[model samples]
Target: MFEALARFAVRFRWLIVVAWVAGVAGAVVGLPSLSSVIQTNNAQFLSASAPSRQAADLAAPFQGASPAATAIIVASRTDGPLTAADDAAFSRVLLAAATITDVTSVRDQGTSADGQAHRALIVTVPNGPGNAPNARLVTAVRDTFAAASAPAGLTFHLTGPLAQTADADTASTQTGDNIRKFTLLFVIVLLFVVYRSLLAPLVTLIPPVLALLLAGPVIGQAGQAGLPVSPAIQQLLVVLLLGAGTDYGLFLVFRMREEIRRGRQPREALIAAMGRVGESITFSAITVIAALACLAAASFGLYRGLGPGLAIALAVMLLAALTLLPALLAIAGRALFWPTRPAAGQQSIGMWGRIAAGAIRRPIPVLVAGVLLFGGLTAGLNGFTTSGFTSSSPATASDSAAGSAVVAIHFPSPTSNGEILLFRFADPVWHNPDALQQAHQRLLTAAPVSALTGPLNPNGTTITAADITRLYASLGPTGSLPPTPPAGITPSLYQTYRATAQFISPDGRTARFDAIPAAGPAGSRAAIDAIPTLRTTVADIATAVAATDSGVAGVDATAYDIYTTSTNDLARLIPIVLLVIAILLAVLLRSLIAPIYLIVTVGLSYLAALGFASIVFVHHGHSDGLNFIIPILLFIFAMALGEDYNILLMARVREEAHRYPLHEALTRAVARTGGTITAAGLILAGTFTVLAIAGNNTQAHQLGYTVAFAVVLDTFFVRTLLVPASAVLLGRYNWWPSTLSRTRTTDTPPTSPQHGPPSPPHARRARL
Candidate 1:
């Protein structure tokens, strides 16, 4: 079937090229803008059932009037203490902040204890990381503060949730672009080095480039259609298409070159190459798509969209490999490998060939040694820990980082990245002293709250009806405070009451508090690890106190949810991928037993890869550990891609076994497919390795290094040695329950190396 398609491609190569051009153009024209749909808010994508989401939903009504984004402004002096002039300048800066468009409110918290810095919170409505309003507000706040005519050596800095998120968005974009550029450079250089022919490298480059052009827009459009796509997922999509597409393209080209070197006509070589490797490529693509598609079962929205999004792009890459790539091969003919020709009937016994011959001859020893090697590596798994999603990148290196440093020095509480709890009561807590005191005491269970602020009265332990009466009277009976407090009320008391109003809903039933966890930053494992206990304790207390509702909402909660969801996804998806791929292999090979061992070796390869990654990143490279998502993502790619080579080689072995003994078939299959499989693995691994160039992007670096190393194991050890060795040891039983296993043990003379059709070659003398 593939032969006929290849023949048609050779005859209609131009038409195929034109079709791809048209397809790319159409993709460009129809691609929807994803920016509007792109979501940077990780919390927004959480399942509705998540505690954070539930809390957000409950708080929506009360939060309707709250600022969409808030900025923490810190003003510092180089001189000893802030002078009267500096204080006056800060007041002017605050006044300027309130006058900016979209500015909802600006409040000066107080001067730092050192008296060199003062802090304030600039709140603005309708603001977000990506929106123009937020961007303008952020810029306006910085500019307005910098414009303050303070004494010499004074400086202004902005650092808060809004500023950090905006900076993160910018950094992510820059890093992703850097990764792409580095990947392209790596592809071009590595292909040239491997192929040794400039023309071959160029031909090798086309398919993946086309795959990106064709798949990127579709994926973006899918994201725009409300499919849950995250920045992390989008980056992975590009890397997957390029790496896998190139691997497929290289596999076919190498096979075709081998056929051509044996002296077949270029057209016949193309047909034969397609007929020989096409099924393996098809199966490979399907396995990958199936593995990724398993992510759909993930309860996390991040995984739900990631699965389908990557699958769609991979399917496009597979289509191009089968159709567009084949046409290119047909059009280029022998010229694709121009300047690099093989002498007629002369075969090259490369490193892979030597390894294959060694394994085929010493099956049991090789198999045992390989297993032991992988087992030793797998031991590292015991020490492995997931590096939870966290940003160690300090803003944009200079201004952003410097500003953050200033904030940390003057206003350390904001820098804690702690927890925020939203509490809703049957009545205004400030109007019920008992409920208010009980709630505060309940929160004390999760003690060491370094800082706590909410709607309660002074000392944060009580609220009395008299206090409420004073609050309203001091505020002129309206929600807004008067220019001066009513008779008998102090200015400090009125200011405190006005500030407390920000945390309470007008309906008097909901309130919010910012609490600093003593553990650490929300991204820290300690912080996330505390969430369940904290939530349970908080919930129990809330119930005991009769608070209408209570839930934790913050970075800490989100991190905990992500960690839990990822663990759940790994547990669920791994078995499904294995079962599905094992079934696919069984059908493809038409043998039940062969699929089982193939899967076993694939799993071993993944473990070996992970072990190696942990050693490099944790023990040696000084990284925290593998990224939390690495194990699952690596498992899917390694198993699916590792099977790619197994199926390729074993299917050929199955074909040869029809004509020769099982042992002889194994030897011949290894000899024939060794180069192509190794090359394909190398290309794929190299592409992922290039992701290490993503500066400060630990997730990218972790994935890049892990996948690259894992693919090497898949390509060199598992595909080349372990699999074939296991097959040779199994002998006829390798094809269990099949008629062929019962049929033959005769010594047959294998076909000599020559320009002939796809047939088994005699076991050659080991080059080693």
Candidate 2:
């Protein structure tokens, strides 16, 4: 198949070149008019179907040109009561905000107990689905607030989801721009260094650039077809394409050069190179694509969105490497290696040659040394901790740091917080006006509830509206509210609240109860821990609600559904991905033992990557921990990438083993292939290192460093030392029962006699 492809590309190289140029130009011309829809993972910002989409749907009925913008109002004072003058000034500021063009409704303005501090209002601004936040309106509000003076000794703080989102968007854009600039510069320099020729590096970089340009249209079309594309996909695509794409290009070029050195014409060399390396490239690409595709198993829209996009990018780069690259090489001919010809009669001998020869001489010692080194690094895995998504943002940044400061001062922890809770009742009995009023009063007195609305229905059952008002409410005039709720409602009411809190079916048989912790929304260890308690509370409420009538079913009984589902998903999906990768490796290499060792090495590399990142970003970097997705993502990249190296090195070893005995073959194979693998590894690693330059979030930084470190370690240590050492020790067993052999056959070139090259100078001197 690769031979046929090479033939077509060499036969019609110009057509391939023209097609690429046209496609890239067309995409560039078309992508600019594209929509700039800023999406986020926040459930409140999307609909229930997908977190962002569901949030949008829920906010639809609020009546606006756009969804309302959320705002937090904080009132603080030194000593006196919050006077009428202060209230009037604050109200005027909010009222002035309503006059802005996109302004729709402002809700929930009120004073707190003791009158020393209060929450005056929440500002809701009109926003369309997928629209950028109304920054103009927010600016106007800020200006209005700044212009208004509070009563003497009073101060106010204003912020909310909209404000934070707007700030994040601006920061992310700036950070992305900076990242791109630095990444481009770094790639140029790094590639130049590796290839040692400006033209070769330029040629090497083209496929990745082409892959990225093509990916944009593909992703856009997928989005149009209703596939979710996360906001982060664009940035990730750059890293993914450059990392994998460069590796593919390097493999093809290295093999082509080797073929050229073996007395083949340029066209014949290109075809031979593709024929030899194409299968391995395809296998490696498939493994990576499959690994990324596994992310679709996640319930979270974020993962689902990224999975297919990354898969598509990998497939595209693979296709280009197989087809477009050969065509380009055919056209360039030997010029692909311009300014530096292969040295006359000289051969490349890499570190692997020395290591492999030493290992074969002392296999046990080498094997033991490798085990100790890997084991020592693996020990760091014990310190690993899962990080929250929001924690990816730099804590020192204005929005993130300021937000953290506010939460620490006014609440418990950020992760333990909930923004919105919806409830349903099982029976019409509690929907009665009086019963509903009682339920509302009960909710108001519940431990987690800060404010409760008047009952809207007249049944014995109804959904209660409780705002986690304390989240936005300021410190009391004296500083901090008592931890416990004041006594008023009965134990039955508390029990009923808990029972009805579960997200129950619409039938009067189920009820839902919800609580907003003092912290903000999203995942955290604290959030994970608090969920069971919240579920228990809801169960208690459901039991009480059920007592009202035999027909009543506690509908809202599953408050921990999202958390439980996500955790269960991670456990199930991770193993499946690993198993699938192992199977692919086993099949491609045709060796069970080799696959096992390769998988283990890759796994250890992944663990080391994660451990190193955690230490740098969490224990030392002062992040709470590595992001929850970091470990899984590292697994996919590391395993897939590690497989790329494995295939390259193992394929060379198999080829060499066919011509020589086990020990000599291992040494010669490592010598010939090590330089190519090292160059490929360096280029791929350099591409991923660009992520650390992304300043908008810590996740990118951690991901960049983790992947780069893993690639470097895999190339230098695992591939060079561990892999060759094991191959030597395994001997003929490495190929299993395959008919292929390590012993030289009649068809093989002579090892010591007169095949082609002249005898050494020492032999000539002896003859003289």
Candidate 3:
């Protein structure tokens, strides 16, 4: 089948090349920009049934107060309590800030209790679903603050949801060009070094570049059809195409060179090479694609989004590796390796032949050493922990994080983040308004909740919830109170009553309040984990208030849902990924035992990589713990990519074992494919290292480093030392349940690998 495909590709080489070029051009000109579709808000990525989303639905009428695009400007006098003059500067800044485009309103929330700070709310209509408007508004607000005159001690910090998103967006955008340039540059240099030719690297690079260009728009279309596109996902596609896709190119190219050296002309060599390694490359890509496609089963919207887009990318890469790559090689011919030409006749497999022979001879000790080394690393899993979605200090620092710190000191809330608590009763709550107090009191003492503010305590002090109904009856509706205080109502009491309207629905059946979460960053793992207990408290509060419904909504609530869903996604989907990959291996190798042990080796590599990363990021690094997303990503990439090498080496082993003795075939296979796999691993690892240095956040660092390390470990240790030794020990069982197992192999490879004369395959027998 591969031989037929190779013939078609080479026969229609120009047509294939032209079609790939046109496809890339069409994607660039016709499709939506990848950035245009990137998801901005975390909550937007949640399922409609998520608790925070449900809370958002119940609070829809209060959207005016709970604007999606909102920020807080915290003004404080660093040296001491804020004075009247400092307050005047804040007033000016607010007035100037209110003039920014998309800004709906700006209102002072009043001074802090200690008089050291003040916060003002800036609300804006979301111009679009992403960060462009938010970033523009943030910049305008910062400029407004910068242009203001105040005491040198006076400072203004723009913090909260809007500012944080913009800062993160900007950080990711800054790293985009570097991720591409360094990834490409690294791959070219590595290929050039390995092939020892000027043109070979360029020829090898075309498929990955074309794959990268075409995959983005395809994923964006998937986003249009209803998945989420993130800047990180786009960047990951670039790295994956260059790193993993190019590996298939190396496999075919190296094999073609070997075929040419065995007396096949350029066209014939290309055909023979593609025919031989095509199944290996095909299975290698399928392994990656299968693992990624399994992400669709994940309940987390982010993982669901990731699974499809990345799977599409791997598919594009596979098609290019199998079709366009060989076509390009077919056109370029032997000149692709200019300045060096293949010496005709069978040649030695060099140093790796001796190493393979030694490991094959001492299979027991070699396998034991490999297991013990990785086993020690696997134990580092004990140190593994989670830091949650976002950390206070990420690899990419933002001004908003710094501002939040100052805001914490100025306005010492018990919780670092706040949640919106909503209650709806069977009847109008104004009729038995004291239930508002019952709910508020219950929440104030709740361990993970504090500083409850609602209809009963609007302005940080208790008020009669009935006074709210009475004031509205006397003045106006809950949302529209009299412009001024009338007879007998003191100004402070009138102000409190006006503040109370937002908490109580006009119909009076529902109520809303700001329930400050317990003291920790909203994105912390502990904060996410604490959500279940907090929800229990809310349920208990609902029962005490006798309300029909209750829930908490905010960043913490959304993060909790995503965190739990991601974990569930792994447990439910990982087994499916393994089963699918094992099935592919069994079909490719035609042996059930091979798939079982192969998956076991890949699993060990996955754990060792993650364990080492845990030691670096969780145990020793500045991180509170490794980000929760790292382990899942490591497993998929390692299992899939680790199998890439496994498939290639095993395919070569199976091919050679057809004619040579089992031990000789094992040596020849390792010696033959060693350099290509090594070069492939280096190129793949270098691209990931580029991401670790160039990506925008700490999670990227952990993810990049872990995958890169796994690739290297697979290249040098598992594929080279462990698998070969184990194969030698297994003997004929390596091909059990297949015709290859029963075949008697008398012939062997050349003995003096570096200097032996080429011998006919059926007649030669090699001695170790």
Per-model tally of clashing residue pairs: 0, 61, 0
Candidate 3's TM-score reads 0.88
| TM-score of each predicted structure versus truth | 0.87, 0.75, 0.88
Q: Following a full C-alpha superposition, what root-mean-square deviation does model 2 have from the true structure?
A: 8.9
Report lDDT per candidate.
Answer: 0.72, 0.60, 0.79
lDDT of 2 by residue, 648-751 (tens): 77877776565555666667767777877888888778767877766457667777888899999898878887776777667767776465533333123324
When 1 and 2 are scored with lDDT, the better candidate is 1
Candidate closest to the true structure, highest TM-score: 3
- lDDT pick, better of 1 and 3: 3
Model 3 CA RMSD to the hidden true structure, in angstroms: 4.2
- Candidate 3 lDDT over 395-448, as tens digits, reads 225667777886677553432356778888888776776787788777878898
lDDT of 1 by residue, 678-721 (tens): 77777778778777556456777888888888889888888888
The total number of steric clashes, by the backbone 3 Å criterion, in model 2 comes to 61
| Candidates sorted by lDDT, best first | 3, 1, 2
- Scored by Cα lDDT, where does model 3 land? 0.79
lDDT of residue 645 for candidate 2: 87
Indicate the TM-score of model 2.
0.75
